[model samples]
Target: MNSLPKRIAKEIERLMKEPVPGIQAVPHDDNLRYFDVSIEGPTQSPFEGGNFKLELFLPEEYPMAPPKVRFLNKIYHPNIDKLGRICLDILKDKWSPALQIRTGNFVILREKVLLSIQALLSAPNPDDPLANDVAQHWKENEPDAILTGKDIVRFSVSEKMDLGIRQAKVD
Candidate 1:
């Protein structure tokens, strides 16, 4: 039927075959419209050395409505909230159905957006932040903010890893 769900499944299949380096996303068998993704932190970024997880879900009205994407791993990005919601323009006000009509075009756009997100992690834009307090600190003192950001990133990720190890030991 080439419905939204079908198109998402097709795109996800192609992504699996030609996967991006350091980024992995695959459909959940129980929910083809929902994707489980993991992005390796980019080198030299504050998020570097941390393994981050994310989820992307295609809403029923997707293409007309932007996909719902959020970080599952704790991150300290100004553009991302503690709950994992992102404040990216393309995922918000800039979505257009034309971008997803042709499967090939959709693939390209998806890749581009992913790359842009990676870049965002490498160099956060404090001026356009979703986390207001973090943004304020970043704007007032850039160097200190970077340090604090890295500290938070390290702490959050390490805590998650520790919890995982504990669970493994318990089982």
Candidate 2:
């Protein structure tokens, strides 16, 4: 039928055959229009070793517009709301047809965004946020939280390993 769903299915199939590195997108079996995406956390970021799941929906008017993407995992970042909604220019205000959502393109975008998110986690931007409370908390109480190690969850996997080793040595 070459319907929107069919076209998306075709794209998904092609992507699966020639998978891209860093990120992946696959159909959820139950819904072809919806895709389950997993992005590996970028290195040198607080989210390293953290695998994030996301839901991508291809609208009927896709190709002409950007697909709807939302995180299914909990993430603490300036550009991502507590609910996991991303606030990227490409996903929101600056989407264009020139941007194709192929497997390669998706992987690139995911990696780039994750890098930005890592930077944001290190230095949050509360000027614009989907979760105002999170932003406010970062702005008002970040220093105290850092001092108390309250908001720190061992962001990096290597950091966790190092901490474990140090504790083992002390013990």
Candidate 3:
């Protein structure tokens, strides 16, 4: 069996060499099991042009256990809490020993990690959410998520809005 550190190192090396588009991973100078990743918001999504930071920690059991990832940036999203916790199935209830830290053309890597993150951006999982207010806002305001992408651009441009402004603030 591959030791946890070795497995994590290999995964980090792979991510560094051939990073997923919009996502880059870098290891800490003294921590091999922990890595810093930056994921660009998917194009045409609420996070478009927004850069988000994530901290990934591969535990002692690695492949047998899912890596823990927490948002390091303050992102106001339905699936992410104010404290930066992410509510994703793979990181929680759906984690499996088969999944690994990769975003290449493979089930464990691509499908489980990158695809899921994209899906989260496309459709926040309000049913199981870490941020209650964000979820409620998303559920109540039928078109918020789709409209949110444009809002980011608008906020940067003029910071003026006639409507949907209340929904933007998760408070």
Q: Which candidate has the highest TM-score of all?
A: 1
Ranking by TM-score: 1, 3, 2
TM-score of each: 0.83, 0.64, 0.74
Q: Which stretches of candidate 1 lie over 4 Å from their true place?
A: 1-5, 100-109, 160-171
**lDDT by residue (tens digit), candidate 1, 1-171:** 244456665677678788888788777877777878778779987778777788888788866788788888767778887898888878888877666556545564455456667777888888889988878887888788788768877897789899999999999
Candidate 1 TM-score over all chains jointly: 0.83
Model 3 TM-score on a 0 to 1 scale: 0.74
- Tell me the lDDT of model 1 at 107: 64
Best by lDDT: 1
- Candidate structures ordered by lDDT, highest first: 1, 3, 2
Q: Please report how far candidate 2 places residue 170 from its true position, in Å.
A: 34
Winner on lDDT (1 vs 2): 1
- Residue 150 lDDT in model 1? 80
Report every candidate's CA lDDT. Answer: 0.76, 0.62, 0.68
Q: Which 10 consecutive residues of model 1 have the lowest summed lDDT?
A: 103-112
